[model samples]
Target: MPENPTSQPVPFRGGGFNPRPRALIGLAVMVVLIAVWETGCRTGIIHPLVLPAPSEAATAFMELVDSGLLWTHLGASLSRLVIGWTAGTILGITVGFAIGLFSLARAGMVPLVAAIFPIPKIALLPLFIIWFGIGEGSKVATILFGTFFPTVVATYGGVDNVDRGLIRMGQSFGLSWVSIVRKIILPGALPAILPGFRISAAIAIVLLVAAEMIGAEFGVGAYILMAGSLMAMDQLIAGVAILSTIGLTVSWIIGRAEKALLRWRV
Candidate 1:
């Protein structure tokens, strides 16, 4: 005899798909790709010198770990990223606020920012090298230059979109310009500036590597360059993979911070 339709237990739908199962599937896909690449390399279908297989990269990673060289390169790269990104974000937010708050500031800075926006920062690499020398200063300056403009533009847009009524309400209370900006303008602009930083963080990291590659004694970028020059394909691939992972991780952290700080936006 068949059971009544209404008598069956309700299936769990709250999980949609189980998180563990979804994670396992993702891992399976990564494993499959790695396996395919490994097979291709072993069979000579893919040139190992040109594109090292996952296994080769894994071996190189272990070698670097054992030699204690990976940490040195990683540290140098991270330090530069921190210094450069901080400078860029601070400058961008300050200028953005000025432009958003005053018509005169907007009229002057907006045109200047717009004019420079189209210029490739890489073109200024030579200038930075000339002024700062091919050292840590130049490297950090290059990254700061690369990340600054986008952040400033995004932040200015955010501030501009803030509701004027709120500003008027604050003014009705006889709040000073500084007080209103601190209490209202910044909070309103937070949402726009958050995404800008997320993008800028990634760009800053990339610029750090690029700067290091051009002129640095130690950095992940320099490691990759040295490996590539020596035909150490596995090491080169490992260095690049590490750099990419770091960039993604930094972006994720910034996004999480943004969500936390902008919780009131909801």
Candidate 2:
């Protein structure tokens, strides 16, 4: 591996924009921010009424754990999130594929989706409550409705963006339409669809919190609402932290899925 000054080879420039992990950097940033926040609160530079210290939030979080309400709230939220997100994603993908592959579906549904996608899904919570009642049904329906439209847009967009040349080559080679779609189109579309999952998951979480705040009893959103009503800023922050943890967990799960399913790119 000696460097030859007289006969130098060209440097390799084919390496794409590969991302490397910087976990420690992110951790350090969070630690520093918390330290500053705690210091400010202790020194009276930051008012407790305005922003609670990180330690106060931690104490509230531990209190929930000690009372065993943490599990109850987390379990309820996770159940709704899973059921709603799974159902919406499956349905969106099915309809998306149809729209992407067919002229009639594309013509009819695209306009409908465009019209509905812009409306804030949270605004329809009252209607859902009226239809499904102020129960688990309403909450799940809220999350499902919020998640469905974005997923449809992302999925169909992904399919549309797939290379037509590859599809034509498949056809010229006498490959079946099903085979072309399964092999070439599906994989090509995954890069977009997976990120769509991320968007839908975030929407689902937001909708879950909004819906639960209405009439739900055993959820992180309900906990946050109660804490806010009682002026318990620390507990409110703790609830927010719990939501952040859920977001992080969902993101990690999606990253793992991408790693497993998109190995061809590696």
Best by lDDT: 2
Candidate 1: deviation at residue 107, Å? 1.4
Q: For model 2, give the 10-residue run with minimal summed lDDT.
A: 1-10
RMSD to truth, every model: 5.4, 4.9
Q: What is the lDDT of residue 225 in candidate 1?
A: 89
Tens-digit per-residue lDDT, 1-266, candidate 2 = 46765776888889878989876998899899999999999999999999999999999999999999999999999999999999999889888888899999999999999999989988998999999999999999888888889889989999999999999999999999899989988888998899999999999999999988999999999999999999999999999999999999999999999889878885
- What TM-score, to 2 decimals, does candidate 2 have? 0.90
Q: Residue 193 lDDT in model 2?
A: 95
Model 2: clashing residue pairs? none
**Runs with alpha carbons beyond 4 Å of true place in candidate 1:** 1-31
Best by the TM-score measure: 2
Candidate 1 lDDT by residue in tens digits, 1-266:
35665566778667545445355886699789989999999999998777888889999999999999889999999999899999988998998988988899999999999998777777788899999988888888888887889888989999999889999999999999898999999898888998998888878877887788897888998998899889999998899889878977887798788879988865
TM-score of 1: 0.87
Q: What is the C-alpha local distance difference test score of each model?
A: 0.87, 0.93
